[model samples]
Target: MKHTYTDAMADIETLDTRPSAVVISIGVVLFNRREPKVKMKELNLKFGKKEFRDEQIMMGRTVDKETVAWWKGQEPDAKRIFKQANVTSMEDALNKLTAFLTQGDTNYLIWGNGSDFDNTIITSLYESFGMQAPWKFWNNRCFRTFKGEHGHITRPPEFQGVKHDAVDDARQQARYLQAIYAELQKYNILSYKERQQ
Candidate 1:
């Protein structure tokens, strides 16, 4: 029987991860492949100035100048959330994300855009703050891999909301995955939820 999952589509905007990367924002959407509804959450955080300067302290997590320059090249709307005046501390953001992930008893398959991007970065950030990641390693999933496998499936049009905003990105990705699953069902390509009794 093919396994199905209760997915948490997650995205993060960050300054690059060379020596040290700082998270600018996070977005997550909780949904089950077998279900149609979704629940979304997001956070915008302030980077620590001291950590930004200390190379050793930021080992394996440095922000790249190129990434910063690329961000500047993005559209104004894409950069709008980062410019918001009120941003939460990393601790506060992590706390809220933790609460959101563990709110119910459901086991989430945390789907990041790539294997080493959102989830990995968030885990590293949590460890830097002396906190454990909310989800387990076994729960990590890669949206890019799924997309690659189903490249023929047409995705829904890009969402009109803020492009780089975490919450909007997560919601859009979750909806896209849901649509793909629905199409798969319609064509009888795979009975994702069926057991081979």
Candidate 2:
């Protein structure tokens, strides 16, 4: 079946019984997407909901620019900074994400676990921004990765250990997806047999 945000939500209802299509994780590290094996030239996104109320609740709690910079052990690269239009509000965040999806040459979305909170936030932002969500692609059909599971994939040994430290978690997620993509290629090779009713 085709994937979408709606299908993803339904899948979330089924939890372990369902697989996710796309995810909407927070933090720069959470959004990395890089090719497997090579382990170089990462892609990152910088977007998040900014409901004034949510912002208030998050202050002194959620990682802020300063805190994230400190954690990175350096200042944020200029290009990696979230654009002002995207950071202004939750609506802006959605607008920015939509632009990222449509304006870019690439056509893929990933999430470490999008079905849960990330999807919810993006869904809200999309509506608030007055856009028709490509619900299917966003729902049940995007790629995904997980934390602390069997058949585990690990990042470059240099990046080394895996932990929930949002940074490492995100890298592990990319590694997991790289492995899944390889497995899917293997499955594609067997598809002809499955189709030969």
Candidate 3:
């Protein structure tokens, strides 16, 4: 069977780990589960520190003390986005993501690191803005779950950029997930042959 559906890996950097996390950055990469270049989109939100957290809290977003402490303990490189000069508001960022995800494709399988993390947070943000998420709910996927289930592949891609940077993380995730998909295809083909014997 020919594969035609588009797959994407979405990631976010945030101040909390809940559905209502105060999202600060987002990265998404659209690709086929094959070795090829991907279309990437990234956005860094302008953070006003206490003011920003208060504003998002007003809109029903959340923050966590441990997440804040974790960020403080990270290396300076991983925390660079907080110092970014060029940034967008959350509304504009979500709008751009919607445009990117829905513009060139129809059947999409959007992957997040975890089922309850990236996609959930993004969807919550859309709800905060009273807007619709671009991808269908059923089409959402969990890369963390897939990896945990079938992580038998021996080799994986090298890390590209700083750990906390959303864009770099998304690219790395999509590559590894693609490797897993290839391994599954190989296994399926072998299993079919065994069944025919």
- TM for every model, in the order presented, reads 0.80, 0.42, 0.84
For each candidate in the order shown, give its overall lDDT on alpha carbons.
0.70, 0.35, 0.75
Model 3 TM-score (2 dp)? 0.84
| Model 2 agreement with the true structure over 1-197: per-residue lDDT tens digits | 12221111111111111122121223322222223434222223333223432442333122344533443453343223322123555445445445544442333443535544444444443444456554444423233323333234334333433332333444554556555445545556425532231
Candidate 3 local Cα displacement, residue 52, angstroms: 4.8
Candidate 2: minimum summed lDDT over ten consecutive residues — where?
6-15
Model 2: what TM-score?
0.42
Candidate 1 RMSD to the correct structure: 4.3
For residues 1-197, what per-residue lDDT tens digits would candidate 3 score against the true structure?
22443677888889999999987778787777644444444433335345555667889998899999999998898787676523356566668888778866466688899989999999998999889999889888898987887776735688888887887888888888877767766667435532332
Clashing pairs in 2: 3-136, 4-135, 4-136, 4-139, 4-140, 5-135, 5-139, 21-142, 23-114
Q: Model 1: per-residue lDDT, tens digit, 1-197?
A: 22333668888777785314777777777776655643444443433234432432444456688988998899988776555533345567778788878876767888888878888888887887788988989888888787677646876647857888777787787777777777777787865433221
Q: Tell me, what's the RMSD of every candidate?
A: 4.3, 10.1, 4.3
Candidate number of the best lDDT: 3
